[model samples]
Structure formats: C-alpha cells, structure tokens
Target: MTGRENRRGRSRCREPQQSNHDVCVVPEEVSAHEGKPLYVLVALWCLKRGGWVNRGQIADAFGISERSATFQLTYLSRKKEQICCELRKVKRAGVPVESYEVRVTEVSPEAGVRKVSEKQREAVKTIQRGRVGNADGDVRELTRNIWNSLQRGRKA
Candidate 1:
C-alpha cells in the first residue's frame, strides 16, 4: 500500500459541499432609463411562471430593488394600451412590505375598442332575439306610450 493511502482511512476524492456559493451571480439592478416596457415584460415573465408570482421573485429575477419593482408594476397598471395585469399586496412575516403578486388577464392589444368574446356576442344576440324577456312589460309599454303621446301633443 502507498504511504498516502495508508495514512488516511478515507479516500481523498470526496470533498465538502459548497452549497453557500451561488452557481450563477445576477447583477444588482436593472438600468432605470428603459422605462415602463421593461416592467410589462417583467410582469409577463412573472405570470408565465404558472402561478401567483410575487414582487420579490420579480425583483430577484430582474436584479432590481423592491421599490423599483413596485414602481414598475404600478406604471404597468396605469398604461391603458398595455396588457391588463393585476397586482395584490401579500402580507407575510419577515417581509418588510406587502409584496405584490401578478396575474395576467386577457385584454385587447389595441385598447379602447370593444373586444367581446364569442360567448358574449351570443349572449347579446340572444337578448335581442327575445330569448330573455323584460319581466316588467307594463313599464316598457308605458314609456313607449308616453313618447307617442308626446309626439301627438307636439303636433296638436
């Protein structure tokens, strides 16, 4: 047996685990000048994670401060032309402030235009076709009669 192998009972191939060392190091923060588009993209990324993605995860992923994340999210909320996203503050122990969780809702790419789904269109058509009737017919007839009487009175 070699002198080194004899001296130590265990093999030297085994080494202590270095779990504390990060496999990848992310930067500290994102540049501030890029504006709100960055926030929208970040929000989308968070939502794509398949569940309620909180603000801290967003901040960590983007290498930004929580305050920056909040500001970006708030800006995203105000942009009428952008995708609709929801943010709710979550309260938990050891967190300095209530962190936000982002949920994406379906919205039209072009804002301020009527964008109704097929189901909604069918519902409207059904209503117009009298599948749904006004329970108070007397009230409706009275309003029509009042308009006719006014037209007659105007002629008289």
Candidate 2:
C-alpha cells in the first residue's frame, strides 16, 4: 500500500506538499506549558496543510473528539497574534463549519508572551507563597489546603 492509501485502501486526506518555508516554530512559552503541546501539533498540522481546516479534519488527524478539536481551534484562535492564523465560520456543502486559515511561516520567541490578567497574576502569587518546601509533607499539606479552599468556594 502506498503512503497515501490507508490499510483499507482508502485515500487519506490530501495534505499540501511541505517545503523548507513550511515550518512551525513553537515558542518557548507554548513548549513549556502543559496541554499546549496538542495546540502546537494542531498548529503545525494546519500550517503544513496551508488552508482552511475544519474541526472534523482536525479530529480525524489527531484521533480526538470533534469537541476537543473545536476547543483546540478556539484556543489557537485566541492566540492569533502568536500563531498568525484566523478563525472563520464558513459553510461547506451547506454545513456550517469552524475553520482556521493557517498563514504562519514562522514565529518569534517574543510573540509567545501571553497577556495575563491581574487576577491571574494574584493567583500565581498566592500559589507561589503557599509553596513552603518540596518535601512530601509540605506537598501533601499544600494539596489539602488547596482542596479545602476550593470546597469552601475560595480561590486556591
């Protein structure tokens, strides 16, 4: 079987030919964050495809649910300044689909600095202040305190 054909002999989704210029440069902030790696993968996939990609296409390519694909696309849309893409609502075959136009050729490290709100900053500060030590007892205490605060409807 050829690379274009699956085991069942069905042709795979046509991806654009990759050239040297077709590169997805992930920024340090994206690489360092948890759960963002999937975002990076989706970005890279869209970049290589070089056109409007629908949620179903993303889901099939990544082996994820359509809802999860939508979430990834939505998150990427919010990072448009860093990823150099835009989200569009378009109809394909009379079905409305959420699509992303991947126009990113390269990304600089400086573009990855996400704007954090004052509330987010304060939350980070609170977590940092709560970290007394790396010992097992300290870690357990911190977790318990966070759980308790969450149960009490307070910010952890």
Top candidate by lDDT: 2
Error of 2 at 27 (Å): 19
lDDT of model 1, residue 108: 37
Question: Which parts of model 1 have CA positions greater than 4 angstroms off?
Answer: 1-36, 94-97, 107-156
- lDDT by residue (tens digit), candidate 2, 1-156: 113433444323223233422212232223333233456657766777777787877777654677777787886777756677766666558657435433435443435356799999999877756556667987788899998988889643
TM-score of each: 0.40, 0.44
Model 2 regions lying over 4 Å from their true place: 1-36, 94-156
Give the alpha-carbon lDDT of every model. 0.54, 0.58
Q: Estimate, for each residue in 36-151, the C-alpha lDDT of model 1 and write its tens digit.
A: 23554454554456567666676666546666676767766776566677767888898686666767663334433356999998988776554355657888789879999999
Where is model 1 poorest over a 10-residue stretch in terms of lDDT? Answer: 24-33
Model 2 clash tally, residue pairs = 0
Q: Per-prediction RMSD in angstroms? A: 22.6, 13.6
Clash totals for all models, in order? 0, 0
